[model samples]
Target: MLCRILFAVAISLQRVEAVDPLVDVSYTRYQGTSLLNGITQWLGIRYAASPVGALRFQAPQDPPSDSSIQLANEHGLLCLATGASPMDNTTSEDCLFLDVYAPTNATSKSKLPVYFFIQGGAFNANSNANYNGSGLIKASGMNIVVVNFNYRVGPYGFLASKEVLAGGSVNNGLKDQRKALEWMQKYISRFGGDPQHVTMGGDSAGAASIALHLTAYGGRDDGLFHATAAESQSFASMLNVEESQYQYNNLVIRTGCIDEEDTLACLRSLNVTFLQKNNFNTPSPGAQVAPIAMYNPVIDNDLIQDYTYRAFEQGKFLHLPAIFGDDTNEGTIFTPKNTSTIGQSDTFLQSQFPALTFEHLRTINSLYPVAEQYPNSGKFWRQVSNAYGEQRYICPGIFISNAHARDSVSCNWNYHWNVIDPVSAAAGYGVSHTVETSAIWGPENVNGGAPASYSTTNSATVPVAQAYWTSFIRSFNPNTHRLPGTPEWGAWTLDGYQRLLFQTNATAMETVPDDQKKRCAYLSSIGVAIKQ
Candidate 1:
């Protein structure tokens, strides 16, 4: 399979005609291919230098000018991570690279829109190579240029501590993302993309990063991206730098960096292989506690000034026109099997969010009652997914959309991705996190991707989604730039907060008032009160 992928990429690069111009770098003519009929792709272009050696924990630096034409024939290395192993070849520390896909006809003068994407894995897994943008470029009829890059993940990306703060940036991976965006602004026009009209989008962790960018530094707009889209956006709520110091300390002690005068320097100098193995070899997460998920964006009062929902509720975010949503049953997979009893479930919730008081968790648990509250519900843990899902995925969508709506600036649109795939339906995962990404990205390449051939619903949703999204990238309104036959998608308003539900059922795909309102409201109450 690896050989086949490498072959495909190599073939694509070889097919490039000498007549096609190289991308706008001061180096060798890194010519790529017109791989697909109407689209061209330049793969694994480094946006930043290799983050190896002493540069491991530092923020990504700009890709320096080189005289050699760096052949971008294949995907970049998968950034080192733990818990979730590499989906493709060779994980390494030198993984800061991106790929660009555009219409074959595009040129510096074309000014086509840009769609920048980020992949998801709870800050622990996945990579840019896993999500090739061919499907998107094809879906958009080769009219847009799509960008995807690798960012540090797991401990390498998000671990925070006083030592880390005193040394380098917290959330190094997110800063990697920022650097990539800056790269786009500097060079995308060379590939016929309009950097000024860039729209950043993602699923799961990628979506969480998008949300953070929205609120980074009290909603500052550094002209990075004009709009955003997020699926299953993570709203884990920020852990103050000190709040996660225990994780940092544990890592320090385990890695034998403890007692070093310059602990951060010790961490930076440690062997990459040793650090990744130990720090990321976390215990498997139980149904309710995504303990390792805490190794994510920290509240450093810089990139993140406050908790996610708090930033939303308090009206601090980039306020870009955004389209955000979550999956139906977002918690089925995240909900652990061990917490069958209500007591165990409560314990799990408290352990996950230590800041929430027992009294608060108890009241919240009552709202998501166990014991077949709904006539067809099964075990307590099954039902417990309701609260867990609401707390983690579903409500955060509502929270941010509400926050965007309150601004009354951009016409924020929200969505609910309940689209079922054959694989998920077979496993009873039911419209879980990242299901829509497959359809949007097309088939066969991504994890849980659209199959070799799309199903009936995928056929319906793909064009609709691509058209809707690319249209938004072109013009901030999903309705205005819609495909000829695309359905009307309205804005999510504070009073009329409706979501476009993408599902297998025909009627289920239209705009409707959010069904998770009450649960999301309860989540808001807790988040607002506890300030999570």
Candidate 2:
């Protein structure tokens, strides 16, 4: 009779568990609350989407306090679609949620370091949900909390119009970032993260955004992050407002949504499919579907008060330890094979940029030695790389490194990822943009076959890379005796021009000649030297 009773109770419990619609999570400030199933784990707490309706276009309002209803567990709908990237397709406008991945065993007394990742996709592609922080969280060994939040992207996030400005909407994307950081400041401790020991980091456009945040408004809220890691993007390397506005206006015109008096509203009301279909194309010749042209954060007066490079040059980055670097062949990702054949002659070069004299073109070519090395490669590949490198990576990185070096309170370490995957040779490119991300997070989790391309030598390179990165995350210094092997990370100096070069054979130190470095620097300064 007792055995029979236990069996019946087991059946009842199984049925109840199957029918339970939500999961409950308890936070220090809030009591037990049910959340939408999958979303709860991602956030590690219950959170509701902002309820501010039309005020959604305005700065993000605080999440409502609800004691009764279970916050939905599934991921919030991503913001309205801006393009056809994988991130845009999976997300919805209700996507203003933050995921906190902390050490599962951590406690309130455990003050773990925090890594606040800003996702990249030119501010129009990608989302926080796309990143799985489990590897990074575990690799660091420290109680590391990974926070990923959705910020408005595309028109909703970066619309710059007279009406929107009049209505007080400027840099909505940046404002969203600020609010997310503020939320972390107020609540991260509850999840075992040390708000005081926060390290802000990101890749590609995300890295650019971090750079913007650092230089914006006297590095507002300097207390938020103790260190910054900008991967493959920098302020000096990004588009200024003038350049960005031209592309934005072209996109606005192409989308055919100009009929409405309120462009932001019209954009919001349109079906996600229609907006994406009309506006979807690889904007520049070699660019991805969403390149620097289609969508990006603008230098609006409020969020980005001045040119990001100028801010860095003026020593405005709150004197934080900084780690900044780029892939050796960042441009190859976008460069195609046919570009060189099509524009091999001086006639083609001059025709493309009629304003440029033969002398000017030669001067530009002399600076980018890779063009000479692969003269037959293509005009689009060679010339464009030189131009983009100047506008995006080379100049800005050197400038920021120089600035940080001069700012006594700041320590700067620079790297050039020279390790090229032999497998990627099938694609006829060297180490491309975003190749290092797999190493930083770990190899297996990287999407598709992307990580597989990183050769055996490349795979072996992971430990050193991981050690360097986690060391930075743990102490805000990439240099530590803890790193394996004998090579030591040295401070970059204007005189020595020393930078760490990560190659397949070995991780070693090299001193770049001031002249060669200056040539590379001049190439980056082509259009924006005065601006910096």
Candidate 3:
């Protein structure tokens, strides 16, 4: 009787195993020809490689079929890494793939808002695959699809020559973005994502790219995203065609490719290793001598007709909900090697700010005390921080934010993240640029070791940050009262004069006094020309 009972149990277990396979996925053919694989159990999705090869440099072609393939257990390849930064690992010319994460058991009938992210790397470094959307998606209880794909970086992506321009192809990286948006519009429905409620967002150069997209003619027609959140960088600081050409010519000369008739083709034909060894290996400031000389998006008349700053000023941007801001220490990342601290004496300020009168320097120094702390460092960091705050980051942030506020009917939100912690302290940089990225995407999403301070705060603030992001994605306004552990986000106005300040333990909604903000603004008006 015992043996008979055991046999019955074994048979029941076998039947249960057969009913649910190890990899639980549902596949459907999409875009008429391409395989659209959805991992229903895992709640992930990706596209199979397109069959077209040489046509790759051209626009993205439609997938041949709408049929689904089994996607139960595969992660897509990351874009090829071209720079010497320790953060990058995988890369490829054929890395035009994206991934999406949605609620399990969700169908077309259950549409959830989507957050589309564009990764930042100065248009030449980093890949989208490094970021994982699982935590954000799960924590927020929102259907989120994170698209990570490769647009051409370096010579392969952004080469503009007389021949290429005549052929009508410049800013191929931007073109890749357009194609991705097109893909999202046609197929997000399959993954239970709302096609019409997409929020486009990015950081650093990615932020600049979004700003460019907001002003691009093709971007206007893409009809993919309804809202935008640009972080850290803006089009106001973007280099124009003349500026780009000057940099391009210098790079060509540096790389010994000036003699080539077709610079783009020649650069592409060279081994990636040879290019990296000769150009990218060295640590250099600015765009000069960067490994990916030909990789910058150009101001082609068709897509980008004029300077982005000019476009925003002239009200050429799309009338969409927008949120943009920068951190307090944007220039710390690019601080030059020879920079020194300012002395307490009036004589030192005069030398540094030769353009300013002695009285002006005294007034500035009085407001921003340089010699009070770190006397040995000579208040160099403080002065530099103040200068960069006004000229590079604050000026542009305010200008663009104000522009969007005036031009668009949709709401605008501005933030000043002053969450300086021990991690940045360890790095000898305070509230540096790119510090907030881990908070946005979560610690696991970043590549390098985060500061020790990051671990302490991640448990509480990570969820809060993700909520703020997801809420913004679901609704253009980030002012949801439902977010736990934070005050409501308010509309940023020129008159009320407040900025949302994000910290590790608290989120403060405070009005920045006109006097404090204006000092930086005044300093910016003069310092920009001096730095240029």
Candidate 4:
């Protein structure tokens, strides 16, 4: 009788567990929770093995196969970041996880287009834990699936040295991202996503990553993605792996591993806390106003064979349908506030790229002359801001758009997001970098509300912006499913260089400004010397 009772209890447990949404990717089974908003999310699924112990600083390896029913409920610990302070408990080195959001009714047969987004934090710190695809899914009429994942950042992700090159990978962070994309291509069909129709999207550093991937392996198409969306794409100085030896040496000295003969092995053997304590000791890119990123991607030749500008110029990047654009005042948030003279501004540029020669500085100053005509509180702030914005973010975007246009393989849509938030305007950041992020992802979803004004007076802009984004994910063209009555986004061309200006109540197509065009041309000519 006792044996019979135990069997009966086991049967009851099985019946109760059967009601939740489940997906089987052959090697593993995931039980997902259904949210009240008709969205089902399978969160915190490991795509790669923990990059700890012998795996530290190495290319990502596939996770071990498992058959158990894993609960995909909460997110995993964020990857340890450099200089992210008061260091929180919710961070770890074993953080190679991803999340998937889709309509509740989606099945293996749904085959919805997928949007795989890479979060931006200047390559030093940041993760995709806070992003929610519910609003984006709803905006797409529940016709798509979205994926976000974490990649190793800072030293763990980007440490480069001769010792490292011999034993481990040079660009582990980027390798982690590529691993996640490969995971999607293999397993996304189980989540009702089309492996063949994936769209890769990102902002800032994330966008910059997509740019690198486009040119990775000398433009070798990896069959990972079909389209691209790069908002505020950055083209910073990318030193070859050898040039980044100073960063590696500084880290070794700080961590007390300088005496170790096998520095890479010594680093892998050290405790994570000991290593993290010294991560911030490395040289930082940018100035007082820029994000404090101590490390950046190095040109590894294996992955990044040449500078991005040369890749595009030689037509060595994958030609794909893409959309590239930036916010109006991208540099306001990244430029120094007290640069009162042209010399100080040159110093700021040198801080970002120490390799900038005196000739380059002279040319840069000549191109960006003192425009006292512009409104600003600082003596040379606006001029410096314009120079930083164009050289770093804006011009790179335009160059890539033009490169795509030269290919003429597929349509490339470009936009200038000039919509101002009252809060940002008051803070002296007029339509600054990442201001349109809330417009793309719903206002309420990002970090609980940085641009909460979108839900208030600027509410009308949300649907229009999301419509263009989601429409591009669903179809290659943004105009395909763009909201009715909104100005049609035109494909950028070498001749016209037309782009849609996204302003509240006055959205329209405009030609690339002559001032910006001339500046970008000069910057593009010196792309090699700047190591862009």
Highest TM-score, which number?
4
TM for every model, in the order presented, reads 0.89, 0.79, 0.76, 0.92
Best-to-worst ranking by TM-score: 4, 1, 2, 3
Better of 1 and 3 by lDDT: 1
C-alpha local distance difference test of each model: 0.72, 0.60, 0.57, 0.82
The TM-score of predicted model 3 comes to: 0.76
Q: Every model's Cα RMSD, please?
A: 7.0, 10.5, 10.8, 8.8
Ranking by lDDT: 4, 1, 2, 3
**Winner by lDDT:** 4
Summarize candidate 4's per-residue lDDT along 1-532 as a digit string, tens digits: 3223322332232111112378876668888889989889998989999999999989999898897999999887788888865257888899998999988877776778899999887888764355888889999888889999899988889888888898988899999999999999999977878787788999998999999999999999989998899999988778888887878888787778879888877888998877777767444444333334557888988899999999998899888878999988888777777778888788777777666778988888888887543335567776777788888889999999999889874468899999978987776667888778788988876767457678878888999999999988887678767899998898898999899999887889999989889988988888888788
The whole-model C-alpha lDDT of candidate 1 against the native structure comes to 0.72
Misplaced by over 4 Å in model 2 are: 1-56, 68-81, 85-89, 127-129, 235-264, 280-292, 341-362, 369-383, 453-455, 513-516, 527-532
- Which 10 successive residues of model 3 have the least lDDT summed? 13-22
Badly placed stretches (over 4 Å) of model 1 are 1-21, 27-29, 84-89, 281-292, 371-378, 445-448, 451-453, 456-458, 481-486, 505-515, 528-531
Q: Per-residue lDDT tens digits of candidate 1, residues 190-253?
A: 8878777788999888998998898898889899898888888876645777866777787889
Residue 70 in model 1: lDDT = 68
Cα misplacement distance, residue 163 of candidate 2 (Å): 1.7
Candidate 2 worst ten-residue window by lDDT: 12-21
Candidate 4's C-alpha runs over 4 A off are: 1-20, 284-292, 369-377
Pairwise TM-score winner, candidates 1 and 2: 1
